[model samples]
Every structure is written in structure tokens, then in C-alpha cells.
Target chain A: MLKYQQIASDIERYIEENALQQGDKLPVLEALMARFEVSKSTITKSLDLLEKKGVVYQVRGSGIFVRRHKRKGYISLLSNQGFKKDLEGFQITSKIIEFDVRKPTQEAADNLNISQEEDVYYVKRVRYINGQTLCLEESYYSKSIITFLNKEIVSESIFDYIREGLGLNVGFSDIYLQAGRLNEEEAGYLGLEKGFPKFYVETLFHLTNGQPFDFSKVTYNFEQSQFFIQANGPL
Target chain B: MLKYQQIASDIERYIEENALQQGDKLPVLEALMARFEVSKSTITKSLDLLEKKGVVYQVRGSGIFVRRHKRKGYISLLSNQGFKKDLEGFQITSKIIEFDVRKPTQEAADNLNISQEEDVYYVKRVRYINGQTLCLEESYYSKSIITFLNKEIVSESIFDYIREGLGLNVGFSDIYLQAGRLNEEEAGYLGLEKGFPKFYVETLFHLTNGQPFDFSKVTYNFEQSQFFIQANGPL
Candidate 1:
């Protein structure tokens, strides 16, 4: 990590440890500089980044205070990647519920642009962070493309297998997000009550050749997750 | 709309009107060209754009077919803009539920970067699309900055007022999205059953000068909404 990022992490840790509430003022700039053993400019840069991230705000003469709303477990929607890369300091694990090669459903066949006669590797799993179930994922992969997938690979990150093991670059994905009540089976897997609200995501992963290889439906526990996306203005 | 876009829209309308299903083959390329009275290249371009948008896919020998999943509403995560610009065909309206200037709560004070003693203009409204309630929003604005707001303005687009009325450019916003069940009051207003799952959003808006000014919480009805974000690969 860069020096500024390290300093920011230290400050974030301090805030978390102290359980700082909204509008609670932090230590003075000089104090932060002395405590972190950094120069004024370094402290200023770190604070600038933090402010941009909506962590704290400056009141000119009144000093810096914590913002009311703080983000937790932000999943960047922009990256054609998985949460394993972004989630730091959390132990993530997956339990494979069902993994088999089966005839593609009409929906799966249409999503992957394959015929109904073609077989697909269907995998369903529940993902946990720190032993708490966070998301339930049901995915279908074109067997013709991901021909080498097995139960072992299904137990881990499929994206890693595609990029590292298969040497196929994951290019982009089309994601649709909505809200829904968890069905009985999903509730049982996530340890939630029946009909609890959940965030639902449907994604189609395309390869570098612009051919979609995988389709997935993921349901995230409402209270334990947050999704983030950063957008720029049109040129 | 551009020629290609117009052709794409026409094709989309045809699909909707015909109630096209997954794997349903579209008209042949020559047929589409004849119907649209355009050259092969224009038709190809429109189809390419639609394919990228996950509307349709192609088989090497068969032809184009509709994809299983179609997105209805897409909220661009990257843009620091409003939904009005993106929702072109829909008739959107807002009903003011509560509008008042009151002493800022600690959370609102911190979110807006104002002192506890300062007053904040609070606005609550429900947004409708084609006569259906889609989202309920509660927002707080700093009275010292957005000083000209009224109930009439609150019933319309606040972003329009900030730009056209106050002449202040609405800059970037830090948004947090999560899932939650709607309470009784929100359920009643949105015509959803109590305990229905909904998508919740928390946004903190800043000015071009990097001053935080507005904070809002929007609850979107799960069944009637879908959010889309397109992310480019890292350079």
C-alpha cells in the first residue's frame, strides 16, 4: 500500500476503535501529524482522500468531523471482477450446494447463446464472510467453453479458474440489480426468515471475444451487504 | 435519435409488441433491412449495439435471438446526474409528502456538514413512473446554501431546481445501496405489503467546490425496478 493509504487505514482503524459517531470531531491536524509521525502535507493528502470518500468533512474553522453515513462492505459494480479482490481483512469461504453437468434450461441456453441440446455446468453455492452467510449464487456455464471445470474448481473462485487456469480473460459483464423476497430455499441457505428482503443480481459474463460464457443469479443478504458504483459525466 | 438508434428502437418495439421470448429468432438480416428501408451496414450496427446491451445474441449459423434477461430501468452508477435524463420515454412525477425546515438532526448535520444549531430543509416525496409508485425519497439540504427551495420545487425535480433555478451545478455524489424491508408507513405510500423487500440508497451530494450540501435516502420498490451499471476494464 502507498504511504497515504496506510495513513488513511490507520485513521480508519482509530475511528472504528473509538466508535466515532456522526459530527464527532477528530484530533487537530497538528496532533494527527505528530501521532502519525508525518509531515503536514502527507496528513493533508490523506485527509483529502478521506473527505472525498465521504468519511469526514472539514468545517473551515471548526476542524474535521466524521460523516453521518459510512459505507460497509462496498462491492464495486464497475469492475468486471469478483468481491474476493476488494474484500480485505475478511475470511471468505464458499459451500458448494450442488454442482453437476446437466442439460441447459431454455433460459440458460438463451443466455449463453447455446442450443438446448448442449449441456451446461450448473453450480449453486452460498458464500460466507467470517462464517456469516452473505450471498447465495446460482450459476450456469457453457460446458463447451468451460470444459475442464470440476467439483474442485467449483469449490473455489470460478473467475480465478477462468483467468488463471484456463488462460481466458474475463472482459465485461451485463448486470441487472433488483430487490426481492428470499424464497424458502434461499432463506434456509442464508439463515434468514422466509420472505426476508434481499438484493438480487443477474449477471452475464462475456469473454474477450464478446461471447458470453456464464450466467448467474446472486442474492445478497439485505442487512450485511452494500454495492458501490462510480460513474463519470459524459464527455 | 440517430439512424442506428432509431432502427434499434424500432426493433425493440417489435420485440415488445410481439412478446418475444428467449431463443426466439428475429427476422433475417435481409428482412430487417427491407422492413427498415436501410442498408445492411446500418442494420448491422444497430444489432451490434443491441447485442452489447444484452438485448439479443447471435449464433454463427442460425441468426439473432432474444436473450433471456432484459433490463427495464438502469441507474447509471458513474454519472453525477438524475434519472430524468436516462428515463426518456417514461412519464415521471413526484408527490411531496413532507417539506419543512427544522433543526438538523445529528445525522443530517453531519451528512450536510452543517452545525447542529443550523436549520436544514427536509423534503420527503414519492416518485411515480407511469402512475406506479417506484421510489420514496427523503432528503436534507443545507439551508445556508440551497436557500430558495419550496414545496412546489420539492414536488418536481430538485436537480432541475439546483441547476436551472439556483444556477449551481450539481456535482458528484457518494451513493450507498443496500436491501431492506419496507416499514408500514413506506409500504402504505408505495402500495406495497408491509415487510416487502426494497432497495435502499443513501446519497451525499457535493458541490463543484467539494462542499457537501445534500443528503438523501431513497427506497425503491423491488418488483418495479432494476438498476444497471456498465464498467470498463482497467487500462
Candidate 2:
């Protein structure tokens, strides 16, 4: 990275470490220069980089201020880590409705790369944050890959269990993000009217070995979620 | 890539080239084996790879069939290619509502990395598919970088003009996908009711050199659009 780029990132981290809120003032130009031991032009270039990213902005007469609205409200690109990991720091909790090992449906068998005769773990849950319901989720796991599952595991982070306990590497997912409406039963659980708008996300997750292990459908309360994506390149 | 993975991708392309539909049958194992000059085991392995990806499925006693439903109803991962390129083959047209060189707002100046008094190419448009309105788009382009614009260029593709004509590399974007309710004016353009749910996409597009150039706001008609995302890895 260039000197300005490196300094720009350090100041970004400084804003985060200090937990700067929107409209909060950053340190003055002279202070940043003294701290970084850089020239005025370098400091200005660094601040310009941050300004371009909408991380912070300069006021002609007053001072520089934090501008975080553009940075927030995004679902980051690395969402394959699972929502729990993706939305870390939120008070997330899951209520398991059903968990069972049953015969795979033909569709599940194909997605999980297993035979219909084989068993697969089926799980259904309601996800909440701060005791407010947010989503309804259902998933099927390939028994050959996941090996085991219980209420204790389902109540918390299954992605963590898959990565840490099973010692497996998580890979890419093929996902479909659709706009949908809630049915009567779903509306009752979510405290919304029937036909409320929702985001329906279906994913087929693969292990690093390139075999799929899980298929999930999560319907999120649209009002409570803002999906974010960061994209790069024509390639 | 493994031989099977290679074959799996080829079969995926074959499905597209053949324009196969859901539940449509693929070539039999014997035919595939002969077509690729491979053994029956190799052909089956390739099919297994396809099955795991939900590209195709096999019946217990019957033949394999296309499973394009899981594949379609999606926008692809290469959406950075711009929506027109992303949704290729669709009949698309754009109606120019507003286009002019104007002063940037403070927020627009911050996003475009230009001074508030600087001239910017302001564009407002309505995009349609098969004459069905799908989105309302507005953008501000830095005049310093874009250099030129007109009705002809704006009517077709600014992304294509930026790359092929201006010889600049299009870089990544920071995007926030929010579910918003339409106001009266927007609803009129989209033929939806006031308070109709829509996908509000805000993007800051940069050139490969890392300078932000285009700041765009697009409100999509949700019922007519299904946003697709494919995610990969913890990284």
C-alpha cells in the first residue's frame, strides 16, 4: 500500500477503536499530522481517501466528522460465514422448533449428494434478536458430512460447530434472494399480518472439498433487515 | 480442477447452450460416456458433481433431468458487470427523465469525491423490461473523469461507454440493499401504490484507480425483481 493508503486505513481503525458515532468530530489536521509524523500533504491525502470512502468528511470551516451511514446497512460480501458470524455483536438467539434425522427427499438427496436411502438431519427454528423475532429457518444437513447435531448445537452457532468441532473448511454457496410474503402461520409467529413482505434466502453450502453439506431456507422480516453486498471487477 | 469438476462445468454450459428447462432430461450415461470418450464411472462422477450443485438430479430407476429452477430466478455473481450485462438477453430499455450538468449536493460531493461547486452529469431514468417498468435510477457522474455524455450514450449503457470508450477499468462498489416503501412520485413512475415495498439500492462506484466516480440510487419494483447473490468463503 502507498503511504497515504496505509495512513487512511490506520485512521479508519482509529475511528472504530474509539467507537466514533455519526457526526462525531475526528481529531484536527495538526493533531493527525503530529500523531502520524507525516507531512501536511500526506495527512490531507489520507483524509481524502477516507472522505472518498464516506468513512469521514471534511467541513470547510468547522472540522472533519464521522459519516457512517454509507458504511452501515450493508450485508458484507463474506456472508457465507453464516448470519451469526456475519452479524456478530448482535444479541442473536434461535428457537428450535423441529430437529430430526429422516430420509432425504429426492431434492435433498440431489443437493446433498446422497442417496434417498440415507438419513439427513432436518432442523427448523425461529431466530430472534433481543427477544424480537426476526426470521424462520429450515435446513437439512448431510449426515455423512456434519456427523452429529443436537439441540445444544442448534441453539447456538451451527457454522461454528461445523468449522471448529468437525474440523471442516466452509466453502462457497449458491444463493437465491427472493422477495416473498408471509403466510398466516408465519405471520402469527412473527407478529406481522399475513402477506407481509419478507426476504426469502435459499442457500446450498459446500465444504472445502467441494461437496455440498447443507441446504437452508431462511425467511427474514424485511423491515428488520437490510441486506448488504460489496462487489468488484468486470472479471 | 479435477476431471469431474471440468466435466460438470461443461455439462452446466451444455444445459444453457441447449436451453434446457426444468425436468428436461439430459443424455443417458452411456451416451455421455461415449460423447466425452470417458468411462461410465467418470460420467457418473461428473453427474454427481452436477447433482451436488443442484444443476441436475437423478431418479432411482429413471434418467437424470435438468433442475434449472434452483439455477434460475437469480441474478448472477458477476453483477458488477452492471444490471444490463447481468440480465443479458432480456429486452431492456431506458427512458431519460432528467440529464444535465449541475452542482453536486454536499452528500453527492462527498460520495463522488468532488467539490460541491463542481459540475456533475446528473441523470434520472426509468428502466424497463419488455415495456414493464422495473426500476427508477438516478446517478451523478464526475465530469472531470467522465468528460462527456449525451442522450445517445445515456439511453444505452454508461458502464459500457466508461469501459469500452473511455478505456477506464471499472472497480468495486459499496452497496446497501434496503427495503423501502415508495412515495407518491416514485409510485407513479413504477405504477405501484404509495407505500409499496421496493428494493432501494445505493451504490458508490469507483474506477480501478480507486477514485469514486458514480454515485447511484436505484429503486427496484420488488415483485418484478428477484436479486440473486452467490457468496464464497470466510474470507
Report the Cα lDDT for residue A168, model 1. 79
Model 2, span B1-235: residue lDDT tens? 6787788888899999998975688888888888888888888989966764556767656788776545443455436655665567777788999999999888889888789989999999999977888789999999999999999999988898998889887865667766657889889998888877777778888775556789998888887787665554444
lDDT of each: 0.79, 0.77
| Local accuracy of candidate 2 as per-residue lDDT tens digits, A144-185 | 889999989988889989998999888656676766668897
In candidate 1, stretches whose alpha carbon ends up further than 4 angstroms from where it belongs are A1-69, A233-235, B1-69, B73-81
Question: What residue pairs clash in candidate 1, if any at all?
Answer: A230-B78, A231-B78
Q: Where does model 2 exceed 4 Å of error? A: A1-70, A84-89, A103-110, A113-118, B1-70
What clash count goes with each model? 2, 2
- Report model 1's chain A TM-score: 0.69
Best by DockQ: 1
Most TM-score-accurate candidate: 2
Docking class of 2: acceptable
Interface RMSD of 2: 8.4
